[model samples]
Target: MKGRTIILDHLNGREAAALMLDGQLEDLLIACDAPAPGTIYRAVADRPVKGQGGMFLKTPDGNAFLRQIKGMAPGDELLVQVTGYADEGKAIPVTHRVLFKSRYVIVTPNAPGINVSRSIRDEDRREEILAVVHDTIDTVPHGIILRSSCAAADDKDIADDLISMLALADQVLNDDGKGPETLVEGDEPHLLAWRDWVEPAEVVTDEGSFETHGVLDAIDALSSPRVELSGGAFAYVEPTRALVAVDVNTGNDTSMSAGTKANFAVAKALPRALRLRGLGGQIVLDLAPMPKKDRRGFESALKAALRADSIETTFVGWTPLGHAELQRKRARLPLTELLN
Candidate 1:
């Protein structure tokens, strides 16, 4: 895997981080941490809106939604975690299920269970990693999940990371006396994603850009509508209101052998393109059709490529018309919103 670069843009009231791989935007994240992910805040429950099907919880940021409502009352004070970003004219999504993370693991306070990353395909390796996690940490009361990165980590590294996470978990659970609407600012959401998710090689900020990396210049050059791969192959990615559509065209490459090579290049490029743009949802890939046998090989390569991604993805197989169907769990704001 090639190392990526991180570019941080801070202006006025907004902050954003763009992960660049080979000068192309691999993963872009917006810092909307007023009530960020992993942040625990005290909120007062308000009356449930029968029309909306959720209760209003008043926190420091504002009133957020409690979808299930539980047994919360109008004056009840509760500790909640911001799960998802606020929708347009809607409350920030909050959940009682809070989880703490280290580089290789995620510890869930309320839910006590062992779960592994779905991206980890090798069942044997998954079992091996889970065994390590179970054997290393036995006293933790919270649920522990081994991240995909744990497969590459050794026993000592996992143990050290677990100890640190346990301490943080204890701290989060013991804190008291904070007023309502007060935000328990944990990690900078982007920094957590950079460290645990993307794991970029070099990070360049607006202030750091002038030093040597030419990160700003790279971002400028790579900002284009179409991505041109070697052998004159290209992927035209367009985002729609519902899902993103990517078309692979072998421009001016007439040889049959070259076309086959182009399709493989497109296979490699498709996952990278999707990751770079942060386009998730039902992804349709329209490519030059290959034989049924070849399609299986291509699908395997595609899945392997997607394993690098932090988000959850399900490859729904190819349609009769040869369009590849995929569903990726939305990880962040769309590319348009992030760029804007």
Candidate 2:
């Protein structure tokens, strides 16, 4: 019930990971049936869309669409990485910028250089990691990015991680094969939890961990649109085909500052709600009636909340009719989509 707990489990026979903090479900990642993000493929350019400046690719799985196809021909063969899931009937979204990701390092084949994460500000630690990188990945043609997790890791372990990533990068980039094929499948849920969730937490691998830790009950609450916030405030997050709509309510608070209080609570809770649901794209917020003077505070609160989120979100400013707008990246499939 304190700190964090990373639970490696399965949901409906598919791999799934859950992060719990203070006995509450904080985040989750579930592997879908389609190609996972970060999967590498040797793709052959098929045909280009007329006005979209995009090209369809042929991979072993299926057709993928890559935008920004400069200097690309229809018959050329190149490597691509799956960026995210596709719309219901669209081609899988792929990108030419394929990155080799690992627990401690990320190998960039396009750019060759050694860089450390900005979060590691200690000059001594940075220099120590750099020395390890030089010793392990010397004379490499590809780029190396030392992730922040290496800051507290042992030098030998960091070196080993770098070596592993470098080897994978070399194997994929230097492939001389002619036909289309999947070079590397993306990390499954258990592996993804081990790689990305960097906080110190209890690793719970026992089967039925989800139900035992109340994760299943929390997920059931997520199915409804209503999200109960602190201090008798609540918000409804409903998704439609076009965009997501959120409405905040003061709920039994009759004070003059009730609206402001409710809006602030929504600001702090919105990111986690969207993240757990895997909802993205257009989001419009309708707040309870509040003073126009409180707009700046609301924006600042929401901005601080979104900063902690891993998803890419653009705060597109407030609407003339007193609604907040945001554009979030469609990274993971909606939790509802996977659950249903």
Candidate 3:
């Protein structure tokens, strides 16, 4: 596997660590701005729990000391220290070397009956928003998802996400407050990353006409050509009670030899099957077995068939039962799963 660096700036250390653990970032080497190896820093937890979260510092006895302190709130800034790592053969130990100690600007609402004067100044709006935030924290337990708009956000965007979250909380309160439904659906970053990484050449759909879906739209936006729809050539065959079989037939043409034609057709259609339906798991390609002289040609054709799909495939020669054995990459869901 190849390695790459993903720089997540302006994020405190814990946020960066969480992202690394989630496999969103690979080969993470955390570094701090300070020159020293054990310099301490701190940042507010995006999702903080009372009496639960803190950085671990090493004691004089060579044991870890879990430093427990409180002050940080969501979106509050903190400094973080990058500690050294201990190696135990293949296993590497991470040691925390610093602490984050700072008081956050408390944004909480005043008493309900208190009459507060309104102001038109920008600073006034900031204070007002902070007040709403404080009220929201007290009334509803919710976390914030800092948006990219936050970089140059001029109060409006931040207010919008906050307001949206509040409205969702109110809706939950009104409808007997069913157990934890999604209040807001954030963009799925993985799909976007996958799209950016794997530039698919063509997208084919079984449905004759193309409809706009976010995934399909993203593919189209990358200028991938649309594979025109053709009549279904894929079929399911129940050859035995233990296993189900999928057969690709040359349905339209019957003039050529069954063995040669079948081999050619299977070779041609395998990639389409892999991509269109995203087939994976152990796939047994049952090509029509040809004479001894045709074996080499068939193998060559099968190899050529798989080249366009962008998936690593292994040709496992032939099974004892005479079916051609092939293995494609694993996918989350396949056409067979959908059909069943």
lDDT of the candidates, in the order given: 0.70, 0.92, 0.38
Residues 176-271, candidate 1, lDDT per residue (tens digit)?
654465545645645665556534377666654422444345445435659787788887888887678878777888876655566788777776
lDDT of 2 by residue, 116-227 (tens): 9998999999999999988875587888899999988889988888888888888998999997899999888899899999878999999999999988998888899999
Candidate 3: C-alpha lDDT? 0.38
lDDT of 3 by residue, 20-77 (tens): 2122222111222212222222222344334656433332212222233365444443
In model 1, which runs have C-alpha deviations exceeding 4 angstroms? 1-35, 41-59, 62-80, 86-95, 111-138, 145-164, 171-183, 197-206, 210-212, 257-263, 317-322
> Of the pair 1 and 2, which is ahead by lDDT?
2
For TM-score, the strongest prediction is 2
Off by over 4 Å in 2: none
- Once fitted onto the true fold, the runs of candidate 3 whose alpha carbons sit more than 4 angstroms away are 1-244, 250-256, 335-340
**Higher-scoring candidate on lDDT, 2 or 3:** 2
Distance from true position, residue 190, model 1, in Å?
5.9
By lDDT, the better pick of 1 and 3 is: 1
Q: Is candidate 1 or candidate 2 better by TM-score?
A: 2
**Which residue pairs overlap in candidate 3's backbone?**
41-79, 41-80, 42-78, 42-79, 42-80, 43-78, 108-134
Q: Candidate 2 has which clashing residue pairs, if any?
A: none
- Where does candidate 3 have its weakest 10-residue lDDT segment? 99-108
